[model samples]
Target: MPNKLVIYIHSGEPTQFSFAIVNGQNQLQNIHHHHDLLPQESFEEIIVIVPTEDILLTSVALPKMSRNRYQSALPFALEEQVIDDVEHLHFTAFDYQPDGQLPVAIVAHEKMAIWLQALDALSLKPTQMLPSVFALPYNEGQLQIIVESNILVRTGRWAGFASDRINFSQFLHALPVGSAPQEIEVLNFSDTSLAASQDSLFTYHEKFAASADFFPTLVQHALNSPGNLLQGPYAMKKTTLWRGDKLLKISLCLGVALFSLLFLYPTVSYFILKPKLTALNAGIKRIYQKQFPKSTAIVAPKLRLEEKLKKLAGGGDKGGLNQILSHLGQAMQTESNVKLKRFDFQNGQATIELTADSSEDFSTFTSALTNQGMLVKQQSANLVGTKINATIQVS
Candidate 1:
């Protein structure tokens, strides 16, 4: 996109705005002037450069004057109190004085200035927020000489012959025309008619030329210059126009495709393999029935047996059997004459056999098991030589 350029209209008695584009060599290309009433909303985007009385006075050779004298003499020339409602005013002075008593000038308009700032906030382009006088200065050449009077005329050799006549006032600054040596002459024509008067208060330097038809020539020179004024609004209307939801649209499409595949694939698989899966399940059930004749009745019993087996194998149960065995062993107080020969566990029953040297020894052993919460039942007993074989069931 091409760069944007904006120029704001100043506010004054006869306020207006003009602009021109100039090249690196400072030659004007195009010029345009605007004096039409602007919309209130349009004012928000414009940067106004209104005239003011506060002149920036400085000289290359002149001494700096006291602040009191400066204030008394200048006292901002623009009518400020009349337009106090306007906001956002700023002022600066550029002095190019080579002799005594430099002129002071201030540009302002608070409301219009703030409105232009609002336009900047909205990212609009405003290349130059300049006063009408400063803008008019560029209508000619390297040295712009403007003579403000009852007749306003701009004359310059390089500017190629142009003059303009208009109502003049002390409140306005004459536009700059021509270059350094080209003296800009200002004559007061408010009092006398030039046709009948013989006394002349205005004359020109040897380096400058005089002309009566300078306005149209000045305008033509501005048009022919290297720079031209930009048209329309300051900023491009649709540079980075946003378009949302693009990624969301793609994701939605993918999700729909995946959903369709999930349902369709599952349905297709079921139709293709349903019969085979059913046959396999039936065959497995038949094999199980053949292997276990009392399968229905013993299902619960088998679960109980599996649990008990897990406990015996030291896997699922928490050391309860070990604790019971340790307690029983501790309870069996050993009589020197009695010795345990074997211990066996089978089908939820524990068997203990002992050989005793005397009947007292046997009695003591039986009493120990009884005291330790074991249900003892003597299954068989035999005496042979010095050994006694006894089988006891511990429940």
Candidate 2:
């Protein structure tokens, strides 16, 4: 909602220009021209619209050059040619499309942008630079009339059509005013000579004005319209324009990273230190068992030992003593003459007392256990009167 100035530079003459000051409402406040007198100090800011070719074509043709070359070529060329030119001009460019055919480039130069930065360094307010076309309403029903350096084109709906139609560049040559019309009025051109053939009967009315609020209306229309892909250099300048404060995009990114670290710290610590914690817990239990060996139940001691080893080595779940006893019973059951009397598991060893028909049965049991990766040590094997008592150590 700030006052904006639309300054038009004469084609080829960078210094000689005409400016029209308009308010937030798009109402013209003042219009003036300066030719011989150079601006002593830069105005709030300046927006230069330079004519250039499409960036896509430039990229396709000049593939070896940087992408910026497509946009920078015009300004670079201008700065090289013009003497005593404003050295601090900030600008961008876009292709200007007339009648929706081919696009010519338009660049905007902003002296005000540089001036404002200087002021900001000394703690002062800076002037804002807005697009000249942005001030006009964007409604297709509401005419978007542009009066630029003796050129007048009306863009609006005709018949049932609902789009911007730029049909007239002829009015630019028809003006016979002093020099040429530097500042043109934006109004409905439905009644103007530039209207479509079907609306040729419409008559010009001086009282016709825009139908809606200028800024918001245009903003909405622009949002809805099939916008130009190649923005002139002025568009580029506007992107880099000072908006009073330094952007903190990097700081925001750092903050997000820090927040993520806060959430991830516990999970990472748990995974990294889990084995050490388990080993520590197992060592503590082993120390407890050693201190009070008699007080601990015999079954509880072995279970605790298994748990400690599993925790320390990060091993899978181990079967209980019952499962091992059942496996031994099944192995012994395979021999019909072996009558299992007693079985014991102590210090990683299994002891068995059985009444076997012969010594050969004891040999077969030992061979089966040995084949299953058990380290067997024969403690005693007495085969007397068809009874065998065998004690073995399985490490």
Candidate 3:
């Protein structure tokens, strides 16, 4: 008795669907035609009405048996009534009548899978499903029929068929004489014109305009009917804490985000920092050029500066000529007899020509240079009349 959604599937097409919302009071709240399956509201239960031609509403009488035995023998018992192999069809058996006739619904397994898959795509699962013919109002001793896009004829409480409007008479007359109704009433839901019965096979015939509340009316009858095709393997599975469809969508979105981060981070970082690196390199080049203005081939300015300093200091330190002069002055402070004659520098080495008061003074000056961590090599030496003259290399 809770609010429910009733979906009418047309022409075996998942996209061609219509639905109605019935409240707990059994009143029609909304109706939509050719509607998308996305529902804006919630319902306690959902019932689906499929095209009748796709469902085989028939009955079979069987000996009393346990539920398992009845289910196992159902397919073979109805095998002769269907054209397709029993293995390829799905069967749903209902309670037995007084005469032991079990009302049954049969549909192809492939068709059932397709319908369920379509509903699953929309995240919908219907609790009850039956043929559209059952939606017609039923009366005792009278046949009820409805005409819309197709013709639906309900001859008994649980018997009916859906056919094209053009073939209505052919199928109607094909019914067994003993089983045909004494009176027939037709509810026409379309603009199509209906002609009175001329065959005179029935005692009375009546055609009436379909009411504005047709969807709600049909939904009420369907809910009261005892036919549901969702049984055995076709029943809706219980939903887990997390729905499969929502979980899959979430996982796919996360995968896309991770891929974007991995693919774009390095490229974005390079573009963002490229300008800063360029500015720093430019500043270093300008400072190197300003300090050594006369130098033109400026390859590796830092290394070029180190080479210039080495030439000035004869490979000792970055203080250049000043450091070399400081060391020489200290070495000679204790050797007053040693006098500087000439000084020359080339290729990271310095040559000094010196005069000393005696050989001992010259020896003492060279030893002092060696003790100061400078490589001293005496290139030439001569004993003059009263003085010692020597040319030495220091680096």
Candidate 4:
């Protein structure tokens, strides 16, 4: 077992709490550090003990089934004796014994929320919680004790009784006679635990003041308690050695995906479209040969198609696309670095878009076209990244 810090939470008013840090080795780890803690103080790896009066501890003979199914049905089993709605409380059971019955502890949801919230403020999340009354050092019989003005008694392994001193006798009287402990042992015998009317039946003895180390004893008993309240919704998160590694791997995969989208998309598209581009070029040559059987050389399919359209236009006037292409193809001779990116013609108009060293080169080309008696208009254009992109319209 690891060293654990135990917290004993008291009831009412200003909310007092006690704590102790105990290590694993009984002989090597005898250092019992105990202290009272402020609500804002930080602690961790803890077990918490709540005053018994705040929790109803009992046992129910649950049906033999998976733990989840059993837990789901527990509220109904406890419905009759508890006056409030089951939804208002949190029910947690002890570790399952092969037997069907299990010890259960029930506390109000509001009360538990308050306790957990206080602990949360201090960054202390406890791994376990049990009723403080169970820390009374009880055996397989009756045990009675007094802490301050309260009477605490253990009637069974997973059963207990605790109430104000004023109500102890009446509480005891209300119990069925045969249901009393086979034997009752008293610790820290005081007026609250044994009234003149109540003590004669039980025996008591203490070599030293066991009450001096009340906080430490409570911490010990909390560590040794049979049941835990951190169950169901409040169970601690289960962590594994590889969780961080797994998270890093997922983050890396997502980062790779994002980087690929931003920088690698064009390369991926090139590979995907390269084969289709070749197939389309082959299909275009085949169609061109089918139309012009005499032409064995298929140097440029687009130029041949434009030549065919120009011949089909009767070759009388070089006033439209033919004039534009003729002049631009001549420009291509003088400016060897200039390349045509797109050539589109429609509705008695044609537009040429190209990339060049700078806008000045495109302006020189447009001036040259204007000098060639071609009606040319430089359209909207802009620089794209490292390249200068310009468009010109011819009609």
Candidate 5:
């Protein structure tokens, strides 16, 4: 149980499948009781019980090494006994065995390929696959037998068979006389002619509700038993502990998130930058107001400065503050050694304060401004500690 799903697969022309859900106490809680389910339907992990005839369980002796290396040698170890090509068979081995041999399950690749194709259509992949005869109980010194319409017997762990009534007797009588188990318990669900004729060697259990009722027992054992057929290439690939349709849903969720971001990013950026742009415009208007105190209405800062300059030019103040600043910027543009420290202008006149590398640099800057048609006056001139400092007026 332990919250697992069990599926019984019968070998037939089209194949038959039965499913059951079991809980922690080995209790069968639910049975979907339907077949040929749609492709979109799937489970997290499932235990599969295929008819014993579909699989071959045997033992192979292997040297101690990494499991992968042990598996590499399995085809050769089993090659002589198997009639089919070793490469065409699917081999899966169990964990370390108390015996000298390793328990392995073998199936033909074509058979497994057909089963996988059908399961893919149904969107179902079983994590564990085993022979259905594992459902028969096994006890030491006692042989458990269920000889109903079909025969089922558990001789050892991962050792059992499913057969028709005819072959059942042949297999039973073929057992060596001295090798017979000390005790035998037979579960009766139908006519038990084989056990009744030899009641001396059989102990019968009372009948159950119906033969089909024992199906829950089979499924429960499947949940608890080992010998899963998935190993190597057939092993279910895990994606974050999720598989089947769940992984597809997770991928679709991530794609939706990325698609939404394409539109969301620009909208988020616009809201974030709009406020900062407004703050910058406010700073520009404040500087414009400091230059022209008479104008109270503020609109465009660059156009407003040009208008103020035109008004000052009409009153004979060179062109305007803009023209004076433009000529000063142009004069300093080519003179990297001359650095402007501060500048102020008022009443059609500009006072410039700056530092220079030498007095020649200062003379070169003043001459450049004079050539631009601005009258320049040297108000103060001197050499500060390390560089030259000077003050001048322009109109």
Candidate 6:
């Protein structure tokens, strides 16, 4: 569990602030009175409670619409109720009521800018910024009022208003008959008691003692309240994880892959390819021994074979068609999957079509012919149904 710091800014005074630190268990750890200085203590969450007078709490009726459309249409919906132009106000909508009306908080764009700038100067980023009137505890069927320098009222779960103390009576009269709460509970924090009212709006009026520590109690109530004004552009950026358990897991996977390539891959390749290499060398030795039966010590089979072929060709550049054909057949004897499809001899070149099980077999056959001093020109190689069909011209 993490501790949270709640800071409440005094109305009309940006420099003077009161703050409280609440532990994870909702117990008050410390409280500070009006201080011009900001606290240097770190907390997991910081909540800023701004003056309610700067925020207007009202409900607007809106039909079902997309989220983006709802946001764009909100200011126009309550345009007539506000004296300022719609573009100058920042509106944040809360949850819907049972009566199908959406509660919204409206404040001037300039006021929001000022509050953010103040917090920025103090290096305090609030996770949740709310209107202070919402800090008053709300009860069903009752209007909770806190009488301090101003009258803060909480009428519903998401409904509230701040009014001047001298105009509290007029504000009550302005509300429609059925709209007023059934009962009124006042928590007087001021040095003087609330003035008695003769209006019928105060029929079920009652008074309760204010919390011993007013600002901290205000923060405690706000800890559970839902609405936060930091929506859309004002929202706090979430932290990203560059190093953690997830990254460690990824690093371990890469290490295993590297180990497989460096240690396991070559070992597996040696076992698979060793037999093929040995067979090729033995085939070359057999061909060399067949040509030079009386001669021994076949040091380089490919070079010796080429020398013998050149001597048989009268040391000319072109081997005869018969010799070329015979040499091609002997060279391809080791490649079991390679087959001679067709052949056409013209001038001194033999144009032969061959088919092999794979491109690798074709490459081996071509490499062997080229090493034996044959001028092999591969014209085309195409794959057809699990076989490589190729054409080669040799002289």
Error of 4 at 360 (Å): 88
lDDT of 6 by residue, 1-395 (tens): 76888888889986667878899888888887643443565677888999988988888999877767888999889999999999999999888777889899999999889888888887877889999988889777677888777888777788878888678777777776766765566777767666464356455444545555678669879889888999877888653333466678899999999998999888999999999999988988887787888877777777887776555555344567667877797778867789999987656688999999998898889888887788899899899988999999998
lDDT of 1 by residue, 1-395 (tens): 22122343323332344433333343434444532322212211222332212212111223456644443333243235324322222322233244454333332444334545654554444433433233334533333433323232323211112223322322123433223323333333234333233223223331222443233233333332322111122222322221236556778999999999998999989988999999987776664565455667434544665566556545323224553365457656555666768866544566778788766677777777677666779989888776677888765
Query: TM-score of predicted model 2?
Result: 0.35
Candidate 4 stretches greater than 4 Å from native: 26-44, 95-100, 144-146, 189-210, 239-395
Which candidate achieves the best lDDT against the true structure? 6
What would the per-residue lDDT of candidate 2 be over residues 1-395, giving only the tens digit for each residue? 55554444343353444555555565555555643233233344333321111111110112233436645554454464334352444333333334432222222234434333433453323233333343334554343454322222333221111122343433333323442333333444233432332233233233333433322333333332332322433233332434322356666778999999998999899998999999987887776567457655434655667775454334221233443454565657666777767766544445666666778887777666566555668777776776687666544
Worst window of 10 by summed lDDT in candidate 4: 26-35
Collision count of model 6: 0
What are the clashing pairs of model 6?
Answer: none
Per-candidate local distance difference test: 0.43, 0.44, 0.78, 0.69, 0.73, 0.81
TM-score of each: 0.26, 0.35, 0.56, 0.53, 0.54, 0.59
Q: Tens digit of lDDT per residue, candidate 4, span 142-194?
A: 55554554667776667787887578767766666766654544454333334
- What's the distance in Å from true for residue 378, model 1? 99
Q: Please give the RMSD to the true structure for each candidate, in Å.
A: 22.3, 15.8, 23.5, 15.2, 12.0, 10.1
Off by over 4 Å in 1: 1-90, 95-104, 108-124, 135-199, 204-395
Please provide, for model 5 over 329-392, each residue's C-alpha lDDT reduced to its tens digit, 9 standing for 90 to 100: 8999857789888878777688888899988888898999999988999999888766789999
Q: Candidate 3 residues 99-171, lDDT tens each?
A: 8898788889888888777777767788888888778887866778787767788877778888886777788
Candidate 6 error regions (>4 Å): 34-39, 195-201, 204-212, 240-395
Top candidate, metric TM-score: 6
lDDT (Cα) of model 5:
0.73
Give me candidate 6's TM-score against the actual structure: 0.59
Model 1 lDDT-worst window of ten: 52-61
State in Å the error of residue 213, model 2. 21
List runs of model 5 lying over 4 Å from the truth: 1-3, 24-26, 36-42, 173-179, 190-192, 196-209, 242-395
